[model samples]
Target: MHIVFVFRYHIFFYTRCSIPFFTNDTFETQGRRHEVFVNKTIPMVVEGDDMSAYSQCEIYKTSLNTSYSALNMPPSNTSTEQCNKWVYDSSVLKDTFITQANLVCKRVIARANANMIYFSGKMTGALVLGLLSDRFGRKKVLIISTLMHVGGAFGSAFATDYIFFVAMRFIIGVSCTGMYSSSFVLGMELVIPSKRVAASYMLDMAWCVGLYILCFLAFVTRSWDMILLVMASLTVLLFVCLWIIPESPRWLKSKGRFIEANAVILKWETINGKKALTDTSSSKNTKDDIEPESVLKMCTIPNLLIRTLLIYLNWFVIIMVNFGISLNVGNMDGDLFVNFAIISSMEMLAYTFCFLLLNKTGRKRLLVGTLFFCGGACILSVFVMLFFDKSLYWITLVLSYIGKFGITASHSIIYVWSAELFPTKVRNSGIGTSSVVGFAGSMTSPYISDLGKYVHGSFGEVLPQVIFGACSVIAGMTSLLLPETNGKALPETVFDAVQFGKKKADDRNSRLNCFYTNDAFNKDELTGEV
Candidate 1:
């Protein structure tokens, strides 16, 4: 079953059972253990710039709370009626236009590629940025790619016609691919050991927040072109970030720039109030504290190849379900944008809950549990739509939402798991390739979503459900073949990867070595070694 986290204002109600906000504080007569920190200020996430091996990235901010609260409006005092009108009417709500726009863009772009016009400039852009970040640094890549994304967003926004708009969207896709991939890689390298998985999942959470932010922006704005213009204007943030962002010292050290990397680590410690490790150190406080193995070329290893395949398939699953449910909503009688926003908010909540349980539950249980429920939910949805009366649209919708909830959790698992699966050498390349495969799946979604529009057969809904259901089951089953990475140090090479799941007594690798981490540049105090 999909576990929904309903956070209380210290008061939890499980739909039926209500638990009051009971805390055992210092002054408690009953000697309860709860202490309320209401109105207490949490430390702000240090928002600034840093360069990783490939490029200089300026992190905007970070949060530890992965709960639905991340998507929540911080107790805004706005009246409900006032907020509703703006939310519905705003330009930010125009994300609904994207599906239509992207479809139009896809049709146009397909033609150019067919004529051998080298249409996949986005892939080229992605590769170039990947290498650029690797060679020049992650910080520079951040600045440049953000501009590329902004430019693409603007061009797509103001596209005069289908052809032009499609072309701009293509450009936008390329830039976004570059920015998204580069940012993900850099952000992982920036946080402490324990914070990694949560932070990684937060990337998607940020996407959700982006939608809400767009919602707010859309409310305040009017013109679609103006929205694009505003989006473009948001890129100007890169310039401001240049001052505060630090160069990726680890990347510098990886590229044989240790002195600079050391300086950067010192700066990180100064800002975060943690002790910096001497060059090449790591702590072992928890399993998460264990460092990642080095990256190796993806094509060179057998397990690496299999893992890549798994990652790509999972991504395809995500695209299939994400767009399928979303496009499914458009066929109904509702404000499509609001519905999509609600779905996005729900996805954010899924990510948040996953964050809380990820460490405790481990990856295997979560993946399996989510997938099994996802398949069941899809199957249930079909029956609801078939045997039930028209009055049950609400029920069918709930089932679909449940399926979405499952797929969203599965989708998140794919990204972080892929990262963990790869060695440092080919980590980016592996993910990059997986992304292309995922995009191939993504590119096909519109067509898949359109299948039922004019068709008479059950192929539209039934086929998709069957396919998704089968995929979910198969994907979950495949996870069993993979080893439990929980608390285990990442292996640096294919040899180590192959040997990872062997019996305890058969262990050749000490499981305690530095393996594949940037130990000298680490600041994970939890591990204590660093």
Candidate 2:
């Protein structure tokens, strides 16, 4: 009797949920409905016995010998207003900025412009906050950035118009850059040189986890306003957590606050279960004895200038290709949610793979290889799309996934590489400059992805793919000029950066031995006098 009751309940539930409602009389009516333009006005065609209003309208139009037009119709000045309506697939996003702003079809450009504006703000923020972090302190800058982000997120959720929403996104973008740059540099400073890769991996892991969590939240909440509010609250909560963390010891020492630096180091030593260094004077001597140089010197020196330029260029290309692929995933012909989930899952796997190979393969080899791999896959996906039938869509999807994996892994490597490439004094400056320049790529990436629509009449959808792939390939070859800093100590001064990769084998070995023997003193050495 219990089994019979459970079976009946299951049957009833399925029958109730599976019942279909037909807006069009025939199931195949979906394929026949079309969008037509009459006198520069576009409207959706509604047909079938189920649509009585549309059928009546058709009879009225035929009786008057006039065409059916959704737009440019006579205005109804009564108590109610009537306008043409569109049916949008609600599974992908319950409500997006575009949907809320009423930016459909002809007004789609506005949505793209909003995305571009946010990245432009990121460029401005990188320039401003980079210098602030160096001069003020990483922790302070991080806290300020977080507060700004929280404020921007809240502002965005309550935005009254499309322009207001765009402006808020720009504000959020600015704060995000500050938080990103400061937190990364600070995390690197807190760990040993050998363990920096592990530290970077942890940060990447957190980002990937957040991405998946966001997807789940969007699915559950299904409201753009609610989503933004939740994100803002979380960032505010993280700001409170930031108070428990200390300022970077290296940054403190750089500012000549030796006592505070030693206190922070001692706290770290206690946490690590290691003995605190008795000689704090050695750290003071290291800083006071060495003559500090100006940040401008990085540009004056030829080797430093060339290295900085190369790094900046590489960063720009990597980010361009990365975001290009990420944003375009929606345009691909598939279930939007499934494609996004697949891409996000692949990124997580890429981070894990990168962590495993980073120490062994070294930075340069991995960077060069991944760029080429990404570029090649992008180009190949286009080729498959053009030459093959629609039946082979899975092949194109697989190639795109491979490309995303390579780009994601490269992102992880570049952060650690850029931080190591610059000296302590100007490290933030270098990162900020590279990030600012890289923002150009991000700013243009939306338009690049949209190239398909503009040029699809002349060239096929392959033009955007060609541009994305070519940039990746070119950047990969150019990356060969970069100096390898895989297992080496982070440069502490402009002179240290100038001397990077120029040392003899014996000198390198000697530094490595000393680095291992006294890890605490080595920390002082890595930061260069500070």
The lDDT of model 2 is 0.68
Residue 467 in candidate 1 has what lDDT?
Answer: 66
Candidate 2 residue 210 C-alpha distance from true site, Å: 0.5
Query: What's model 1's overall lDDT?
Result: 0.55
Task: Please name the candidate that would achieve the greatest lDDT relative to the true structure.
Answer: 2
Q: Give the TM-score of candidate 1.
A: 0.69
lDDT of each prediction vs. the true structure? Answer: 0.55, 0.68
lDDT of 1 at 374: 86
lDDT of 1 by residue, 233-345 (tens): 77667567667877655455445555676778788778879776555332322233232333334445676567656667776676566656654554444554465567767
lDDT of 2 at 95: 58
Top candidate on TM-score is 2
